[model samples]
Target chain A: MRRRRKGSVVTEILTWVVVVIAILWVLFPFYWTVITSFKKPADVFRLSSIPWLQFTPTLSNWQTEFTQRGPEILRGITNSIIIAVFASLIAVALGTLAGYGLARYKYVKWRNQSMAFWFLSQRFLPPAATVIPFFLLMKSLGLLDTRVALILVNTTFAMPFAVLIMKDMFRELPVELEEAALVDGCSRWEAFLRIALPLAAPALVATVIICFSFAWNEFLFALVLTYKKATPMTIIIAGTEHTQGVQFWYVSTRLLLAILPPTLLALTVQRYIVRGLTMGAVKG
Target chain B: MRRRLREKGNAFVIPAIFWVLTFTIFPLVYSFRVSLSKVLYGKLVGFAGASNYLRMFGDYRFWGTLRFTLVLVLISVCATTAIGLGLAIVFNRKMKGLRAFRSILTMPLFTAPVALGYLGVMMFYEENGPINVLLKYLGMGKVPWLSHPLWATLAICLVDIWQWTPFAFIILLAGLQSISDEIYEAAVIDTSSGWAVFRHITLPLLSPVLGTVIMLRMVDAFKAFDIPFSLTSGGPGTATRTLTFYIYTQGLRNFDLGYASAMAYFLLAITMIIGLLFFRRYRELYE
Candidate 1:
């Protein structure tokens, strides 16, 4: 009995050790980025140093990023916001209806299955493969370098994943409410809008956040589609370099700004992240 | 009544289908068209037939970069899966502060890969960086991380593992948490050793999720671009350029749209094959 208890105690200690390591490994880079953003430019590249300590904190990087590179950075941020929000809205709006259709209705044999596969498989389509065609198509439409082009392309990529997620969301919801609403002389559309939509609100929020993050972080499409007019935050962050050197401080500021929205949204919707990420394959 | 219901369902679905199809299906055909021709300055200049593909197959850099990408995918996917599973298993046990611990652990998935790439630059810096600093404290010499070929690959892999392990962990943890306590209780009684119970029961039950997670990671790893693109820029003389980066440079930089489209199609084929395999396994799991 004593040996067994000792064994468990060892296991317990080991478990906590592993957990601590995982947490530190995950958070350290983010913490480092945050601190590096606050440090002065000289302090950033100081030889043989620790982050978050032994360095004078200054807002100079932020000041410079805002003042010197302000227009471009702000433009990137604005573009990112506009694109992510519109793309997410478009994806969510279209995806919810498709999801409901897939969830509640039976189509011809294998039809639903094939449609779901088509939707889910969009995630597998290499953006590299699709970018050239999108570029040419957008150019033909005379929409290159416009936010609308980004919005449309982002929607295309985001909608399929959004559909699958909302499908799963709708699948989990019981049909009794909608049935009763229909029985009470409500049309199917009205029942859907009044009853099902309200219940699926949380899942909708999760879908929106996921779509928003995907659009915001998308790089290659943004890179190829928009040269100047709609260059999003990711491009701006990637383009942050000076002739002198790495410009660690300025880059850190850009990194911090770029990651803030997705990080906050992911944390708030932590419960739904696995669901959204896996396209609702494994429910969180 | 069924006909009306079907009509309604089609109504609800057709609009989205049209939207996604325009992007995916049209691009696929357009890409294939471009792949079969010579695209010069964004125009189809001549009929290349299989020449673009023939050229790609013959190019030594294409084969070399592909081999490099496959190697990186194998290393990173395996590392991420192993680490993710290990962390999940450890955290699966009931413990103090588990919720808070998990919340912190998942932040990396939220951060963009490009951001992580930049962060990797700072963290993996040869001089005055944290990793080297810690190594120096341990009486070890600094290793050239991103400057050398093999070291650059390893550096990129480390960053990939750091960013993606949480994604795997989250999926596996959800898988783990879904297992009933009763199953473990029964297994514990049947086997005197913990390892025996795990090897026989826990692993078998978890294999499905593990397989799915591995396939997902593999697909993403195969198409890895942002990390190498931002971190090394496929640096040290094309040593770190993966297939996607290669394609990007060919299409975007070199203006060889036809050749780039062919390469991208080749990549798409690889991704599709994996996706099909995954779909088969996923169908088995579900149906």
Candidate 2:
């Protein structure tokens, strides 16, 4: 009894140690960003390593972010929201129908399997490879630095993801409900619109969040495809380093602002993220 | 009803398929054609007929970047998977405050890589950064986390690991949770040691998820550009330039579209090969 108790006590200490270290490793950078954001510009560059509340906190960084750089940051936010929203909406709409088709109906002449693999394969194509073509195409169309260019590219980018998630979601739902709806004098379109769409609402939410999150985070295309007009938060953050060195105060403030909305949105849908990310490969 | 449904389904799918074809499929063909032609001053001057491919194959910088890319991918993928799996195992049990910890743990994954790069600069700053301060307090010399060549590569990989490890954790945790509790109970009844329980049962059951996670991280890390672009700008020198960054310089900066296209296509081939191999394995495991 004495040995068992001793072993259990030792294991308990080990578990707590690991948990604390893991949490600190994951969170300290974010914590530091917040504190550094509140630091005065001079204090931000000081050699005094203020660990937390040891130094005087200033609101100058927030002041600059809101006042001087306000329009640029707000423009970035607006561009990101518009692109992400349109991209997710279009991707979801097209992907839902195609995903439903792929999940439910059989195809002819190497149709279903080929189409599915083709869509999946594009997800593997790196963004860098497609940038040149996109740049030239957008330039020729006089669409460079336009939100429309990003919206269109982001739609295709999000489509494969949406399709994969929706396909899995549709596949898991039993066909009986839809079949019953079909038997009750409903057309296939009506059955799908009224029955399958409502049944897949949870996955739809997951898909929407995933699509929006990805479109928001996308950088390379946004970088290559736009210049001054459609500069997203990502580009603005990347360009924050000035003729001097990095102003940690300014950068941290912008970084915090840039990440907050997506983080909050993601947290609300945390459960679905695991499933949506793995593309239903592992059940959450 | 069945005939009409099939027709409607075809109609439903055609538009989506067409959109993908226009954006993805057509660009691929166009890129291939551009790869075979020489571009001077942003204009395709003439068809070079494999000269660009030949030049890329002979370029030492391309080879160096290729080597760096492989090393980066190996280190980042291995580190992320190992650390993530460790955290997943630790968090697998019921514990107080686990939910909040898990949520906070995922914060890095959601943050933009650009933001993370700026944050990395502060975290590793030489004079007053938290990491260096801790090092000094511990009686150690400050390491140049981003200035030196080796350390720059290491810094980039560390940042990648920091951002992506949470992703691996979520996937692995889901995998762990899917295992039936009866398996562990049976092993306990057999008086299995902790290591034996993990080695004999947990390892095999987790292999598929582990493989998938590594493959996903490898493919993603193989194409890493943003962190290095924002953090080190591919270096104090070219110490941290991966294949993607190299391609960006050649294509955008130099305007050598033909050569850059060749390199891009080569990268596409390599990534596609890895992607297809793992995809085949993934299909086998699931289908």
Candidate 3:
């Protein structure tokens, strides 16, 4: 019994050790970015890992980014917010309706299963395959480098997640409520809008968050489709490279700015993150 | 009333269907047309026949980058999944601070890949980055992380693994938690060895989740762009240029629109094949 007890204790210690290592591995890059964003240009080149020990942290980089680069940074942030919000709103609105339809109604021609699968398959169509075409398409419509163009493209990509997740959500919801509402002289639209939609609120929130994050973090489409006015935070962060071979201090500040929104959003909806990311596959 | 309601129900899906057809299917068809025609300055000048597709046969860069991308996908997917599974197993047991640990662990999943890549630029800096500094303290030589081809590839892979392992961990952990405790209790009665219980009971149960995770990771990894774009710029003489990166350069940078469109279709075909194969094998998971 003593021997078994000792073995269990050793295993517990080992597990904690692994946990600590995993935490450091996950966090160290973030720590490095945060500290580097605070470091002066000279201090940034230093091999110092600890803040206030190896180098003095400063607000100078943030100051410069805000003052001299203020307009550019603000433009990127505003564009990112506007594009992500509008795109996600459209995606969710459309996806919820489609998802509810697929869940509740049976289509003879397409079939619900095939329709759901088609939407899911759209999620797998790589940005690479579509980017060139999107660029050309946007250009021809005179919408290249416009927020509207990005909103449209982002909606296309984000809709798949909304459809798939909401489909699953509605399917899991009991049909009895809607059936009862229909029997009570309620119109089908009324039954859905008043009954099913309200009950699927949690799933709606999850889908919105996921869609928003996907649009916010989107890169390739933004890279290909937008140039100046519609440039999102991602492109701005990447654009740092072209300006005199990548000023790390400036880039670090921008990097933090770019990630802050999505990070906070993800944490707030932490419970739904696995399901969101997996398109409701794991049901976390 | 029933027929009218059914028509309205179908109408719910129309808006979404219209959006997809306009934005996705239309672009794909347009891209296919562009691929077949010769282009000058983004305008289709003439029919190129099969020239663009045939050009790939002789393009060493296309073949080389495709090979490199496959290697990256294989390594990144395997490593991320393995480490994630290991961590999931370790954290499967109840403990103090597990929630906090999990929250911190999943932080990378939400961060932008481009930001992470730029962070990687500093983290893997050859001279004075934290990693090299640590190596120096450990009495080891500094790795030319971004300068050398091999090291650059390794750096990109490490960054990918760092960003994605949490994704695998969370999903697999959920998978682990879903297995009822009574099964493990039953197995424990048969064998006191934890390894025996895990190998026999946990492994089989977790296989379905594992399969899903692997398929998702493979598809995502196959389209990797942001990291290589920011980190290496496909540098060290295009040593780490992925197929997607290569296609980007061909179409956007070089204005080889015809060839880029062709290559994009090629990539699309491969991606669809992989998706279809996984769907065929794992149809039940989706249903």
Q: What range of 10 consecutive residues in model 3 chain B has the weakest lDDT sum?
A: B1-10
Model 3 - which docking category?
medium
- Candidate with better lDDT, 1 vs 2: 1
Question: Clashing residue pairs, candidate 2?
Answer: none
lDDT by residue for model 3 over B242-263, one digit each (tens)? 9889999999999899999899
- CAPRI band of model 1? medium
Model 1 lDDT tens row, B68-127: 899889998999898899888888877768888888888888788887888888898898
The alpha-carbon deviation from the true structure for residue A91 of candidate 3, after best TM-score superposition, in angstroms, is 0.5
- Per-residue lDDT value at A119 in model 3: 81
Residues B1-287, candidate 2, lDDT per residue (tens digit)?
Answer: 22234544687678788998899878878888889998989899898998999997789999988988998999999999999999898777766777788887787777788778878888888877888888998998988988988888888899999999999998898898888888887877686477787888889999988887887788789888888888788887887888988988998788788888889999999889978887787764223
Give the per-residue lDDT digits (tens) of candidate 3, residues A1-284: 11134378887888889998988887788888899899888887776768888899899999999999999999999999999999999999999999888888777677666777788788678888889888887788999999999999999998888887888888889888988898999988898899999999987986787788888998988898889999999999999867757578888899999998987787777777777777866777
Q: Every model's DockQ, to 2 decimals? A: 0.57, 0.52, 0.56
lDDT of 1 by residue, A80-156 (tens): 99999999999999999999888887777547788888888887888888988888899899999999999998899
Which residue ranges in model 3 land beyond 4 Å of their true spot? A1-6, B1-7
